[model samples]
Target: MIAVGRIFRIQQELDCVALYFDRFESFSSTQVTSQVGLSYDSRISRLQWTDFAEAIPKLCCKTLADIPLIDDSAYVRELLQHAVMDDLLGPANGPNELIKDMSVRDRYLVGKLAPRETLDEGNDWGNSAVDEAEDVVPDDLEVKAKPAPPTAGKRTKGGEQPKDDEALGKGEPETSDEIDVSKNQSLVPSSFGITFCVDGEAERIEVEARWGRYERIHDHGITKTRKNKNKKTGKEEEIEVKVWQRIPCGGKMVLDLKQGPVSRRSPD
Candidate 1:
């Protein structure tokens, strides 16, 4: 059976922790008999661990604490200390026998080990999967503006009224009502500058005229009154009339990553 031991190191400067695994042969009857005739391989398989340590400096950590706070009883920091001391002492005839003996039984119980070729192929597949999962946007990407609403009371190029036969059959002509409302509503002019935080600094952007539009709105005050004669009583009565007025409202601006900041002035 083969046993695996995990080692972890917290890199405070990079705010990242690195974990590595060391594999050694377990002291089973089969392993003992096989080792008697096998030659000792002194070269250590620390390539993956060395690569991980090299990558630690470039990692970013956003956690509140420099080191993770976990239960010390489970990790047993003394084991790591002893392992380091043993490595510094000298190379053994083979992998550390004590460490191999203490390996978790379940992981190697199946007696099947992953081949180095399979692991390398799996790493390539993993890298490709990560690339596919990433959301990549092009620098020159442009946002398509929404199509403008058809102008009220405006004819098409052929001077024909746009018809909705389905709506017309229901006695609800859409174009006329929309045109009347658009023409009756009042619009106010407004403009404002937008502020944003760029690279931890406040950036103020001016509003551009094209992106702005006048908003139609109604106010509380009475704008006018009307007198009407009752058909049945033949009496004239004064009635309060509600009026739609256009007021000046601030314009809209869009923040585009590809184009930086974009501003549009409200239409007059």
Candidate 2:
């Protein structure tokens, strides 16, 4: 019961939608009842497992009217009237625009979806962990250090950005009662705590990924040809070279367009 591609979930923590999944032992909750006993699990829409990382970017730009999952067009229009501006999902999203015919108060969502620090605190990772990984991480796979968090609050959507440890200092209440013990059981390093089956083994690679940031991450490996001493001929022979695909916490793993059928397998 492994979970796979393009799955959408309303990140109850940040109140934004997110695309989430990877191969791992299937873990699910039975209609999770919240503190007041209302179940929020049904807010998720699980598409069947398959790979389509390449097509996801376009989705971010589309409005609910453009990509209606439910048949109720009128309802979508209603949500749009009071919802966040178009392009909710995106690396390609444009500046936040106000929904038409709505007041300033009704134009955006009520709460912030993700924490301010998570967005403002760019991952300042170092390359020291590359060689230590099972796969040689490519230089391009590196995510740059994020600039400092915004100092002033803007009146745009998703509430205001955090003002340095304010959420923690104030002991802000958890947005929802959604709780999972599985996070504590993750074997991988970060909160992106899942592993995959490649070449018949669980690749327990450590990654420094941010939760709730949905985007395409292209994985690469060191697949270069280098000269090596041929003990028999004592000559450098041009040999075919293959390398592992790096798993950066930064992106999703669709079957690499560079790879083919059976190029890898999901955990069984």
Listed in order, each prediction's TM-score against the native is 0.17, 0.14
**Candidate 2: where are CA atoms >4 Å away?**
1-188, 192-224, 244-268
> Residue-wise lDDT of candidate 1 within 61-173, one digit each (tens)?
22122334444554556546644633442111112112121121211222211212222445321221112111111222222334445444765689876565432233323
Worst 10 residues of 2 by lDDT: 111-120
Q: Cα deviation of 25 in candidate 1 (Å)? A: 9.1
What TM-score should be assigned to candidate 1? Answer: 0.17
* lDDT of every model, 2 decimals: 0.32, 0.32
Top lDDT: which candidate number? 2
RMSD after CA superposition, every candidate = 32.8, 27.3
Q: Residue 63 deviation, candidate 2, in Å?
A: 44
TM-score for candidate 2, residues paired by index:
0.14
Name the weakest run of 10 consecutive residues (lDDT summed) in model 1. 128-137
